[model samples]
Target: NDWHTAIIPNWLKTIYAEDPFFQKTATVYTIHNLAYQGIFGWRILEIAGIDEYGFLYPEIAELANVVDLMARGILFADVITTVSERYAQEILTPEYGEKLDPILRDRKDRLFGILNGIDTEELNPATDPYLAANFDVSSLDRRVENKLDLQRKANMPPNPDVPLLGMISRLTDQKGFDLVGQVIDPLLRLFDVQFVLLGTGDPHYHAMFRRVAEEYPDKTGIFLTFNAELAQKIYGGSDMFLMPSRFEPCGLGQMIAMRYGSVPVVRETGGLADTVKDFDPRTGEGNGFTFKQYDPWAFFGAIIRAVETWKHRDVWRKLQIRGMTQDFSWDRSARKYIEVYFKALEFRAAETVGGSRP
Candidate 1:
């Protein structure tokens, strides 16, 4: 149950209390994002047909004069989960909790974070129709054709030697466009890298990226619109993907890029930290490049390392293979959800037997 639909879960729970068959059933409420809790005026409580059930506790339903739907869901539901394990923990802090930290802290034991996975079949690079070339992990050499095609399509110089960097994200501060905006021009001036960005959000970023593309037409390719086909092409064609998010709940772009053999150069925050690892040249064990600091130089440093590693064909290929072989599919995550269900059931059973008072 999310805030927008929190009433549905509460209504179901009310009905469950009456029916003996479902009396002991546990209600699970999932918090996809805690920032957008549906806190409305007290009138909503009456509209939701729950005014009769007065919220006596301030923590349960009331946040000042408003009725916090998210709070009610958290209070009534037997279990709560966030999108990623790190994000679940992050929301318990004052910085990320959006004024709900105390309420979440109370239910820390019941809260869970099961990392979200992708539909591997739908995102497969081997069978994608939008790419100029179709290739699998073993046939990575054919990926160059796609790179060349993307170069031509973007009207950039068709130089396969120069590393191509791809970004498919919303142009927002949280997505780390602020850091990119700061260092992109300087990085372009120095490096022999070609950049292609596809996204649309925040008018200022649209103007900013478009200006950059105009200034460096030969090396920079920017499309200030969301195109799914172009996004797939970028995933397939690019040598490296970029996601320097300030804080990401859980990212699917990095996983998609890996599936297409594009190594991600990302900031170590939230799921980005959990997924992408720093590549060690000596060991050649990690999948992609990662940096801990949110600073622009840190992001640029990761990019530089990726480009340097790209110079060594054997090492670069190994990195791509490692990323591609990663199991980012839903099977593992689904099992974790099963475990959550059982844990919730166990908690409900214990509470029922003990006659625990809320």
Candidate 2:
């Protein structure tokens, strides 16, 4: 399948150029992650049926003695889109583009970012079949019962008053496990909080969390593995969800957490910035907690604020309700997708008539 990557794009280009019927159709390419661009050696050109001279084309040659499938797709496709609006802009910058910044900047006008939506119904805490107790914004008492059940399951003592934080993510440097590993034990010692972490990645984090669990058995529950049902339970049961990602293109965890009435504590970068807003004490407006910097102090400060907000039962309840009411379903995102499709068609029509890209 990986070998097909060398052949498919060129084959498609041949089909579009030779077949009038196919030429009339519009092509749209999406960049889900700019970091993984399928960069292979120059030999791939032979597999793509391109001679040495053909590989010397400006578009192919610019990717540095190697061939990049993603770059070729961008050069050939009618329109290019990313998963999030912020990420779309981010990719045009040298910091996040992974050496495709110039290509992305040149095609900025054709680049679109459509924030991906979640399955609200599937993530709804009230209707999630996996939860031990299902409840909605109206029945938060039952929601607390689920928390107690989760605590018992994690063997972290059933105490509904203490703030319980949950995380279901890959424990890697990109996910900010570097900072998390440093601050967790200290945070647990200082606050009356419990954490349920579920994930499996990077032996360093696995050992780090295991050490933390051994030190603070009652306060931390670390599951170094993946379990979908357990993930849903954490979403439904926890008071807050944590995602301190260094750079998130578009995070599904924050959206899903809000859907389940769990406030998100995330670092402000990419989609996390777009979705999670800092709490305004003057107006009490934001849904979740967010920190601007990637520093450990900033992350911990956001947690402190969230824990402080948790102390005020009335304020915490209102914040929970506000989060639960947020709507990030597929309907809006699908409409944007359709709009991009039409734009791609228009670009294709323009290119066909003029025999060049706009």
- Top of the candidates by lDDT: 1
TM-score of each: 0.94, 0.94
| Ten residues in sequence with the least summed lDDT for candidate 1 | 52-61
| Candidate 2: 10-residue stretch with minimal lDDT | 1-10
Encode model 1's per-residue lDDT on 21-74: one tens digit a residue: 765787678888787789788788778876544445566636446777887787
The models' CA-based lDDT, in order, is: 0.86, 0.83
Number of clashes found in candidate 1: 0
Clashing pairs in 1: none
lDDT by residue for model 2 (1-358), tens: 1222324435445544667766667766877777777877877767666665333446434544677777777766777887788888988888887878887788889898888899987788888888988888888878888788889878998998899999999998989999897779779999899999999999989999989999999998889999998899899899999999988988999999888888999998778877788888789999889987789989999998999989998888888888888878999999999999999889878877877742
What is candidate 1's CA lDDT for residue 86? 85
